[model samples]
Target: MPAPKNPLLPAVRWALAVLAGAVMVLSFAPFGWFPAALASVTAFYLLLPRGRRGGFATGWFYGLGLLGFGVFWIRISLNEFGNMPAVAANALMLLLVAALALFYALAGWLVTRLRPGEDAPRWWVGPLLVLPGVWVLLEWVRSWLFTGFPWLFAGNGQINPLPLLGAPLAGWAPVVGVHGLSLAVALSAGLVVVALRRGGGARPAALAGLLAIWLVGALLARVEWTRPADGPLSAAVLQGNVEQSLKWAPDGVLPTLEIYLDLTREVLADSDVIVWPETAIPSFLHEVEAGLLPPLTADAVAAGAEIVIGVPIMEMAERYFNGLISVGSAADRYYKRHLVPFGEFLPFDRQLRPLIDWFDVPMSSFSRGEAERPLLQVGPYRVGVSICYEDVFPEEVRQALPEAAYLINVSNDAWFGDSLAPHQHLEFARLRALENGRPLVRATNTGISAIIDHRGRVTASLPLFERGVLTGTIQPRTGRTPFAAVGSLPALLLAAAMLVAALLLGRSRNTAA
Candidate 1:
């Protein structure tokens, strides 16, 4: 139902729209929206009023502001690589933002309909179960719908120093999965707004509840979910920082190979395992192994270390794959299951052939590896590894968890330059570490290479875009966290159940009224 149009209401509506935008911006504040729980609550409150469909307008505006700020770097890709005229690029970019904003619109609409009253009986239940349930449900839906852009789910905001104990108990951090802790944070934020307006002593109770959540996380952090299965393992991660310009040029092959081998040989004395960023080999694996096989294997064996290098594998009949190969003793091979649509392999490559070449896709036609593959074992550790774009997806990494002692991701973000892509990517890896309760070792082509502990803290790192190696002794843990054992099923099921209950409760209340 539309309220009769009031002349001054448009101004008020505009102000609310701007406030919604501010809330979205605050969602990415330094400490994160989770801690303050401000943005989530504001979003809920703004959309809760009856007879006012402000949710759509408010959500769309906020999304425009949030995406415009968070993913502003898309222009770099569109203008620099897509080669679109400015007007066309901005319009397309806005279209993406608008589409993403629809999820928020859905969130707002769900909350409003679930408001407790004569029409809806489960208003209270909405916060208890429906809020977290629907929110996570939407996130999960978004992750797969339209090929997914599961970037920075509300959960990612709860990373580190935030008492992420729920991460291990829930089998993954709420931030890492669709439901988990991040939904819990949103529920709490809504509760906070509800309490504040009621003008009661509930504020203390809310604050205490918030404290308890963090306390639980702190307690869980103390527990070492895993331990060294046998002994210490040493590994070297190579950061080539090769210029994006020459990395794929035919002339870049020899220099790229030489630089990696040179660095590998230098660090061979110190590390038990050596790693290179995704596609560090430049040329296809089968093509380069002829030249790299003999000496590199001998050197690894001599150093008692395994060499894990990222390369492109072109199979018979021109099927290509982004993969990692382990050389020396205990060596095994693993291919990336999740591939980047536009970057690694174009979705519709044949139709987009000219567009692909324009984007400078080095080897853009890679095939996907099996959904399930064995972990790559290096010495005492069974490594669950993901290549390049795989890290962005938390669920995809779980397929490797049971057999793997840790998570290793190798990427080449030279494509994204020094933009927020690298930092944002690194953050995703950290959340994955926390979610799975596994130490994550990430090696990138041009900087932001890091070693993240099970608690999602960076223990060691090498500068981005610099030619060097990160050498560290990492202990492999044995036990599995709740996440490692079950994945997102628990969260998804919970969300589904909440939605069902909300509907039933709403129906029951309407009948009673």
Candidate 2:
């Protein structure tokens, strides 16, 4: 893929790789330039070394650009909300970005090692098979590694359809899941390489295949994976634009609670389920269990409504968890199954806890909740509930489906301030709703709170950092999507197969030579 040997050729390649990766970030939410996904991938794939230069360096630089620009919001959270020094926050953000970039580094290294010395690898062998296979498998690995930061996935951009195609690529979510789209996105990149490097037949074939992939996603858009279980449930998501600094303040806690109560009381008469943003109550569940919650529960019951709210709760004195609880219709409670690393709990608690004062941010020491906890029962529907970061994981969301009539995710986006995070966070929840064939109710502190339908369409929403009650109707659906029933196994298996096929043929080619 490199040009003629020259002094600046290597530097140029690396620069292009970095720039291409950054271009990929433009495809993601807040930017929503969908075609940039293909252009970025095409450039990155072509920039990959076909000669002696290592692809690993190219890949890491690419990752640095992609993740660096995409998740720069991390610095905002650390500095603005966590009170971390700006310099320290930037350093920590760089540290995380560098560490995660190793996955891409590994992907590039493996692609080179798999089929060495190939200037133009066969269309079926390397371009279509090995590249996408290795790329998305690494994405899967990245999703679960170190409790997963599944942010900035390429598929996140495809939540909307390609411009000319006029089809939502996210339609594939219900079948292959997000990683499948990752694979498809990677394969689309591979197609570009095939078209560029190969002659005659391979070029047309690659172009046709690329069109067909998006065409298939467009066609899949029509399939109804789940049917309605009940009539629309009138829901209200209470978005209290509480400042992160004052949320847990010694004096501001009660007033924050009062803000939600007043908002809920106003909307209860018009809704069946009233939802509050994450940690809207800014206090321990036990501390309020005796006094504040009882009255709130009584109010909801008297008004024929149920309220779902997020709060930190303690059990047995030592076990603290970020929790979600329903009051009035059901006393059901659910703890956040997946806790954010360093944000919710320290990674190496015994050592890391005392070494750094930064990790001591409020509500950072909570323990993980049970994975099989009971669902939040809201009136006649059982809701799949998640807190903050949990909605980003596709499998985690799938685990609650078919049985869960709908999904509710409560988050505190105030941590990220005015950043791309709140917008990107909404896209993931939108994809999950499509993947599982369920309507999603997302209530957030400092907005972009939305009600997404089963088709991954944002039906109604509140703007970022707004103070209001979002009253929307959620049509609960029942039945499983192919993805909901099988999880991500199909996508994983498909990627694994492509990889195995490439490696075996490469082994034979080496043996014959």
Candidate 3:
């Protein structure tokens, strides 16, 4: 890399960085332009600034492009459902976006800060090794920090990338998890960068490296990490298509209950297990316990069906939880361990609440459930459970695995309105299914209720904002994938090793220089 002679080059690079970030999001969700991710990463490497401050500024702009375009739905939730003023909602969205963009700033700053001066391209260490390491590590950090917003991860783009490409990137998921796959994508992009920058056989070597990754992924896709356990169990996922605006209204409560019950009655006869969306009742469990719970239990027993319904649970005087209870062959309750920040419960309430009156979203004050709540048991096998945002955290989804015959995620995505959020959420569920080698039954309030097999394929699904039941036979799996057994530790270790190796090379270069 050489110093630019053109004064305008800096501004041009910054603009392109922003453009790169904006389009990077296109690789995710409804777009599914996985190749766009490669393009974005290559652009990022080419445009990355040399100075620490410049790198930070460039990364912030890039992040502004990515998250600003990616998570605009947050404003919809705040404005439409939270009753936040449009100006305030936009301001809050920008605030959240800017805060998250700082992580990108850190990643960008690190590139320049940790570089080996002129020798950065020596082992192709700067791009191929360092960039991927830092990128995935930072992404892993974002997944857990501030109770984490692991949405729009780099790996999210690679999962089931175009059918024409034939599962080239997704196969690495079960072996290394989402973070590891993210590293692979980043590494691939870095290889492209290195190929373009160097000559005299370098391009062919990089091309070879790229081909090896793709070929290995394609091969892994053919391997079934887990086997089927028992005959397929019929599962019915209910999507009530409830409107977010009317969900918690005092009068809307009865209507909401009826909608779910009506849907349940329609499918109860054929389903081995009936699953409901989050807070399907729109009321606390105790409120409905007397009139609904026991009767529903009896109805399920009579119909020879098991019911897993999501509702709010109130404990003692103050604690309330977003939860699910089973009414069937065996009864069990699973409270949502991971609560959605601000939506489920506000952080720094004393400071923010007084400053902003609109912080009072309905049911935004629920308490976090115990860490080790029981998995819902239906018939002979245990089902791993996640409520709403919990499924986005891979480790949280991995908790019941190796024992949990299948995975169940109950969510109310109505908060995001009619947007890519639900579809993107379905993508995340697919990743979990593929990662743990378990069939996932995803039930949601607005739409995209789906039955995803262990292979991460959508076997059956309902459309968004539609009232319907998705019934499918999910084969229970009794084994764990490498990911399920070790979680993301291996992925983290690999990323760490890349960073360490890059640092050692950089140090040696500096010492020799």
Candidate 4:
């Protein structure tokens, strides 16, 4: 019982574990190369022995590798935006990464405990179903708990090019969210590993299967997920390229209004609607009604177009909302329900008011929006809109679907500067397009303003921080995806069933013993 020591084995295991973690991190891009490669290495590492007690350590190392490498940008936000110094920012980010890594630790424990054995009652089913089930559970916890960081939710990485035929089915994520997709990706990777371990021609078959899957994906991509329905409508997305420092400043107000109007005027002739970046006006709508709104609306209407711009709207005594306004077409507004913690409004700002200036945002307090509203009608078409960070959550977009033919997203990416954050953010929106089977027209203030088709391809896009527009005909979509209708419920139910089955199987095995 002296542990049947194998020194070389321990060293090799540690090295492989570290390498595996590194591979997982490498999937984050710029930070590492080839996510699929790193994912393969990670799949291999997860197969290593942990001997029960060592499971925690194995998981922690794996998490440290996964989050430590993938979320390095957290430090960028803390230092550059939060005004923290490099060391403190790095430490805080590391602590967060470490905390998130615990989920991986939990994942390890579950994986080990749930491994199907010869005597297990549901041994035949456990490997296929139970493993993926637990993965969905852990990923769900990661998404919802702690106000939900939901970044790197596994399936998010699979977007268009991958054979992840499961993307459209995952439309339910808005209601249930990222956990479902994570389960599918984890399960797929797990299947790949299982195929490899069984050896022989299975490896080749699996490889061939993966290649075929990608081919199928490419072919599936050919299918028009959403079609140009009804009459065609022209729209223009106004890119202010407003620098973060001056966006909210008082003097910055006039320049911001001017830039938007100038761009609106330029694109107005060819468009039925023109959109401005999130909170483009910077000033509250009521305050600017006399000076800004009237002229913008009149111009848009007179020139046969509508303007949907982001601005601050006031309600009640002092309540303010980050709102989307329709100036010409319907004269309507949609408030942003999903607020950015600390950036938009501090979570515990009552106690953290003094620290507010640290975030460098003057007006950090804005109330959330209410239930879903009808799509804003401009010209002949009704457009559904989600502002800024709203596009990240699929549920928000689905709320406007069927009612709205085109999905419009307006954002200000000035804060992220030249970081992978914008690309990652755009990828999330693209996935939303694929999942929802809708055309997404994203208009960002600083960069990555893009036109995404139902297939999630960046059909047309403008370079970041450049002050210009890319005009394109957006194909309209009508039908709803399973994800769009039922949301994350399907995935959650599947995960729950897996857990229940695992428990029952374990009990039955004990009874047999």
Best by TM-score: 3
Question: Per-residue CA lDDT of candidate 1, range 1-513, in tens?
Answer: 112223436446545654554454444423344443346444555444454356556555555655666676666666655555667667777787788878866776676566554123233565556667767788788888857788756666566343533332222372235356656666666566545543345457666775676566656557666565655677678998998767878899999988988888789988877889988988888877877877888877887888888888877767878888888886677877777776667877778777535555567667888846537876657888888667767777766766678878899877767677777778788777777777778898997888887777788888767889888766666777677677788868777887788788777777887
Clash count in backbone of candidate 2:
0
- lDDT scores in order: 0.69, 0.84, 0.85, 0.68
Backbone clashes for every candidate come to 10, 0, 0, 9
Clashing pairs in 2: none
User: Considering only N, C-alpha and C atoms within 3 Å, which residue pairs clash in candidate 1?
Assistant: 155-175, 165-217, 171-482, 171-483, 174-180, 174-181, 320-367, 446-465, 447-464, 447-465
Candidate 3 per-residue lDDT, tens place, 1-513, comes to 442422437688778888999888888878888878888877776677655548888888888889988998899989988888899999999999999999888888887677555334474888877888889999999999878989888888787557668668888889889998888888999899778877778789999999998889888888899999986888999999988888888999889889888999999989898999898988888887899987888889999898998999998787898888888778878888888888988789777887777565899989988857337787667889998888889988988988899999999888998888888898899999999999999999988899999988899999888998889999999888999889889889988999999889878877887
Pick by lDDT: 1 or 4, better one:
1
* TM-scores for every candidate against the unseen true structure: 0.88, 0.96, 0.97, 0.86
For model 1 the local lDDT of residue 336 reads 75
Evaluated against the true structure, the overall lDDT of model 3 is 0.85
lDDT for predicted candidate 4 compared with the true structure: 0.68
| Candidate 2 per-residue lDDT over residues 1-513, each given as its tens digit | 422332447689788878988999888888878778878877876777775357799888888889888888899878877778889999999998988888877877777667545443443566678878898889999999878878888777787654565545767889989998888888888888778766767789989998888888888989999999877789999999988887888898778888988898888887888899888888888887788877888888888888898998898777898989888878888888898887888788887667787544788888888868437887667889889899999888888877899999999988888888899999899989998999999999989899999988898999988899898898888999999999889888999999998878878777887
Per-residue lDDT tens digits of candidate 4, residues 1-513?
011222436556555555666575444333323345327433533444534445556666677776776667767766776677888878888998889888877877776666655233343344456567766787777765755666666666655333434333233233334556566555566556546444556567656755554455445544544556874556677777888777776788888878877787788888866777788888888888897777777787788887777888898756889888787756777888888776678888778777645565555788888856536665556777887777776656777777678788888777777877787788778877777777888888887888887766788888878998767767676877666777777878988887788778777777887
Q: Give the C-alpha lDDT of model 1.
A: 0.69
Candidate with the larger TM-score of 1 and 3: 3
